[model samples]
Target: MHITFEKLLYREDYQIKLDHIVMNEENGNRLALYFRGHTDEVMVLIGDYSCNYFELSFEADCVLLRSSDLHELDDGVEFNTIPLVLYKDSALLTFATAWMGLKRDTSRDWTHYAIRAFEQDFHVLSPRPPVFTDLGHKMSDFTVRHSFNLPTES
Candidate 1:
């Protein structure tokens, strides 16, 4: 599969939203998802990332779906649509997180992220990052609250 990206403006709970469009060669199918997270999100997402100079992470909430039925599938395809955190790399690691079941995680925390956003910061484990040579904006200027929770292994 292949992916494309776009960085969005700052928001309340996130610093940036990484937009993605994914395509597969054999089936010619496409999946779209984005993750919005904060500085702590950046830390967790890139804790093990060793690809490049820097990367971004975010506690993300996603909606996953095929491109063909975007409308009828109005169930909300939102995986490729959240704020990202930057680390040693700035590229979205699509393949790495696919097996993590982030989007499919219907846990209460993931399900109630939207409503919870108004009362407090939205938090998650899978933060996202997008690759770029330059974003044409200074990263220091936009600083939101940094909130993250590293899961404890059972």
Candidate 2:
């Protein structure tokens, strides 16, 4: 099943708990996150991300998609709209930190991600939506296949 940004952004009742984070720069700077909430576990994969931009912080409360304000094409880009674009003046200013940059290319599809966690606040801008997959097994068991050790959240 394809999960769009719109679907992920509007869940007011669901407190998405981040289970695991995997960052592999050797594999095209791929970043994968396992989150459990609202029903089952799923993985958000950002593959071939070497060309993309990302930042990580030690602390975060929540995630917010950022947008820019200097461009006219962003007139329709809102906090919960499609064709995600992030600006510094958008509604997410209070939720979490944002990723700032020049006007995005309207010709290409982009996914603005602001993932907040105890050990890391991931801010990423990709040319496409991340691959979302439903986990068939427990997230703990799935993460064992790959060697990853993220600091446990206190």
Error of 1 at 17 (Å): 0.3
Model 2: per-residue Cα lDDT over 1-154, one tens digit each: 2333454555443224455566645655566666543422122221211111122222122232223322333334333321223344432332222344323344644344554332334445454456555453342333334547976899
Candidate 1 local lDDT, 1-154, one digit each (tens) = 1112333223333333332333433423322223333334453243212211122222224333223323332323244334322222211223223554544544422221121111122222333332333322223323557669866899
Angstrom error of the Cα, residue 32, model 1: value is: 3.6
lDDT of each: 0.30, 0.39
Model 2 off-target regions past 4 Å? 1-6, 25-27, 39-110, 116-121, 137-154
> Where does the lowest 10-residue lDDT sum fall in candidate 1?
110-119
83, model 1: CA deviation in Å?
A: 7.8
lDDT of 1: 0.30
Clashes of each: 29, 6
Residue 101 of model 2 has an lDDT of 32
